[model samples]
Target chain A: MNLFIASLAFSVVTAATLSLAAVAFSLQFAVSNIFNLAFGAALTLSCYAAYFFFSIVGIEFWLAIGLAVLFSGLFAAGMSAFLVGPFIRRGASAFVLMIVTFSLGTIIDYGLDGGFRDNSFTLPFGGSSLAIHAGPFELSGAQLVVVALAVVMTAGLAALLHRTRLGIAIRAIVDNRMLAGASGVPTRKVTTVAWFVTGLVTGIAGLALAASTSTVNGAIGDNYLLLIIPAAMLGGLGSIWGAIAGSLVISLADNLWGVFVGTQYEVLIGLLVLMVVIMIRPGGLAGVISRGWGGT
Target chain B: MAYYISTLLVLFVSYAILGLGLNVQYGLGGVLNFGYYLFFAIGAYVGGITALGSDKGRVPALFQEIYAWNLPVHLPYPLTVLSAVVVAGVFSVGVGLIVLRSVRDDFGALMTFVVFLTMFTLIGAYANLFNGYIGISGVPSPVSNPELWYPILALGWLAISWLLVGAVTRSPYGRVLKSIRERPDAAAALGKNVRHYRLSVFILGNCMAALSGALLIGFIGAWSPLSWQEAETLVVFSIVIVGGRGNNLGVVLGAAVVGVGINEAVVFLPAVSSDPGLIPSVQWVLIGIITIGFLWVRPRGLLPERKAKWPWIDSKPGEVSEGNLLRKLRKGEARK
Candidate 1:
């Protein structure tokens, strides 16, 4: 029971980081209509940026987080304006655009490899851990923080999408960009905002991932890149709630399977689940549920 | 000078083989196989271990020489190449059966990536399997004489690969693959087995990739899991995309230029500073630039494959019939 509980707790922490990347991934797909393969590399670059800031400028971890987010957003904006935007202007297919992003990812990956000398960095997120006893479940302060942040971010995103003017524009653009443009919404500007926010989330997710693992390597992005696409697709790439739900499902599936099969095969099991889900319902579990609910 | 050219010559042929295989899959078949490195790894290891001999249940770790089997000398050299192709082909089919069912193109690509990561992680972690990071070394070379035998071996393999590519591209079956790419639904509606066709082409293409890996490993005389990274797949992918995806000639040219040109440049170029990572980093950047340039500019490549004319050439069939037996032989050789 104790081992099961420990594993469940770890799964939640993993889900937290995955949810951030998955949600951002879903949003970018929702608005831009590009799958954004480069998002993983962007997350990697952002984490490295935060690591650099912490090591070089001696900033607090929280401050480093903010800086990473800023840089990610700015960098994303630059990529959108220069790299992705130009290709879109030329009427390139979304698939072609995705490849372009991948090239950019390759560039970023090797650039980091060159800059950081292909070494893994250790991000020390304080030395102490507070343990909590709630009924039969025990929680570390870091794990608690991860879960809390996930909830807060999800809620904040929900509120932002539901309440904001930009969010309305984003929704309109996603549905029909030409129609949205005719309605006086700046689709391009909205896209840029979506890219920036997506980038920020990618940075935060990377930092969270780094903190959770306590080890940041050059292939950090490469390691987790597989998970993001699955989660995003499983959540129905354009749906935020779908992404959150997908993350939870993937996390739980991995954890439950890991209990019986072992941790090494957890990803293998996650992949199995992805295959099953995609086979049965390509739109994902949440996608099916939402569509049914909306239909009625 | 001969040795240097031979080295480049062998690498060019090997990568061209790889590029052609990928071009068939991604370009002709529209199957996004991002984990292509796995097939290459499979070929390399299968060929390496077959030649290196297997280790019987020996001591675990410290004295552990896992699963080494000493075979006859002749058996290790050429036959292992066939085994490599077969093993990699079988693996590709199994992978295709499982992951290729119903997924988005990008999702399929991601799954391939996951496969690559998991497989690589396992190989890296388990020393019992292929000796971890130490890799399989001294796998033995194909040629006896450096200058004479190497080029002979290279051109022999190149001729074989080109013949294979030519046959596939010229066949009515090739048209079916292309039709599947351009219109999956129509092909499916017309009674073509969509999944089966894809799996077939995927398996064949992977066999070619594996064959290329076998040749490459034998030339280098070493095999490592790191030798076939997921990033390396990107380079081959760029070759296909930039060289004109479905065009064989373009793919070969693209492979020669990107694979050989940039690689040799990096190999021979003096490091301005002592940062050892600069070479690979710069090479990656060059690959990125070339890929992006193709996406932006001449994506069709310099020598795109001409549309297949039914009369075998633009010249009428009667004119071809007028040619003598020698001319026919020459034409057949050119076709080969």
Candidate 2:
């Protein structure tokens, strides 16, 4: 009763943060069908960037988010162009590309580790303290902010995808790259922009994740990656809406398991959900996300 | 210096077992197993516990000793190693059933990778299972006089692993595995049970990997979660990819290159900084560079596996479709 409600309330806050990463992940896979394993590296890189801006540069918290997004987005775009895009353009298999992305991520991970020395640094952006009691549950100011951001961002993205010309161009590329190019879509430019925006969103998501979690480290991306991929897969990997919905479901299961089962087994919950979903629906929750639009 | 070189030799031999096993599966069978390290971890624990004898060992912990096992007569070293392999093999049967059904084509490797992550998380989090982060210590050693014994021990395991892999690869079974790797459809059309062949090969390879793990823990006289990481698998994968996949001689060459040349040789490098994290970070970065550089510049590895005599490699070479030529020309145009 009260416990159940409290669990649900807690899960909502987590779901909000999970959706931010999920949607960003969805967008990266959607265009050009790049199952970029470096999504983790991009996330970890942005988290470090946000930390540097706020703590080292003495920037304000809100402003740091914008800076993190800008820099990480640019880095991702360059990386995609130089590192990954060439492979995709060369027409590598989905599996090979996945390994390449992972290698890219590992490169970034070790570079960060060498730079940061494996210390899990804490961001002063958010502090653990008292929370406001809202009915049966308590929500921190940061938690409330995260929820609001998720809601607003979701609305904004929905509009961008469904209404804007850029979004349509991106989706058209996903639907058919050669056909879209033949049909005068400027497929290359649209794809580059899409990858950049994907990077931007991942950067923001990284910040949110760092603020919410206990510590930030070079390993943050790899650790966070384990959960994000499953969540993305749960909804079907490329569907933005499915990614959002799947995150909520995953968060719900995660919170419920934490409350009921031992906290140590939290990661197992996601694995269980992924396996079950995989069994029941191989095509993912939304539809077949197995390289949708990107031809085999 | 003699001791150091011997130690490196021991590690190289151990890693060779892991690489050789992987060669059989990925090289001959075409099964990509990213989570292969899990079997190695299982071997250490199972083999260590079996020989540990329960009378003298206690799991180390932060606050208190967790549990004590009933005193039983300890299994002999040879039997314990056999048991470790068996355990890892049995474990794979369960994994294969799920992974094969859910994952098709290249995705199976990623799915297995997920399993590795899950296994690591569980071992790390639950203190009761493997004593949490601190891990068990004083697991009992196999022989006395390390310098003399280790090389012998290492060589023994290496010989067994090598002979086993050589035997399997030269047999008709190996041919079937290679054929399966090339064309499951053609083999299935000829009445090969594709599912069964895949699982059996996977199980056998995992057993070899576990055997190597057992030997490693026995030599070190202890075991812990820190000793194994998913990244280690990446390094081995890089080895196979670098040394020539599926080629037994190639995997041995890869093991020597990676296990001794890179990983073990680093032990002697003078410390540039005492920052504690500097060395490990550099090592991993070097591995990443090696992996990526090889992937980009020379994907077939230094010693590419000799082309199989089967028609699989030659398929469609004589006939080039207009679409393929168009695609190639388009790629050229795009580059221009």
- Candidate with top TM-score is 2
- Model 1 scores a C-alpha lDDT of 0.77
Error of 1 at A124 (Å): 3.4
State the lDDT of candidate 2 residue by residue for B1-336, as single tens digits. Answer: 877776777788788888888888788887878778889888887787677655543422322344243326568878888988998999999887777665455445667877887888888777766666666566656777767787788788889888988888878888888889878888989989887888888888899889888887776766777888767777777778788877888888988897778875566667766576777767877787787777778777778888645333233533666554555575695354
Q: In candidate 1, what are the lDDT values of residues A1-296, reduced to their tens digit?
A: 87777767777778898999999988877776676767778888988898888887789877887898899988988888788878887887655776788788888988888877537887776523676877666766776777788788888888778799988888888777888999999888888887887787888788778777777887788778667777776787678888887887778777777787776645565566667765777777556323211110
Off by over 4 Å in 1: A57-61, A127-131, A135-138, A288-296, B1-3, B55-64, B68-76, B310-336
Give residue B182's error in model 1 in angstroms.
Answer: 2.0
After superposing candidate 2 on the true structure, give the runs of residues whose Cα lies further than 4 Å from its correct spot.
A57-60, A127-132, A290-296, B57-71, B265-270, B310-336
Model no. 2, DockQ: 0.45
lDDT of 2: 0.77
Residue A26 CA error for candidate 1 (Å)?
2.0
Candidate 2 structure quality by residue, lDDT tens digits, A69-122: 899889878877877778777776565576677677777887787776546787
Clashing pairs in 1: B53-B69, B54-B67, B54-B68, B54-B69, B55-B67, B55-B68, B55-B69
TM values, all candidates: 0.88, 0.89
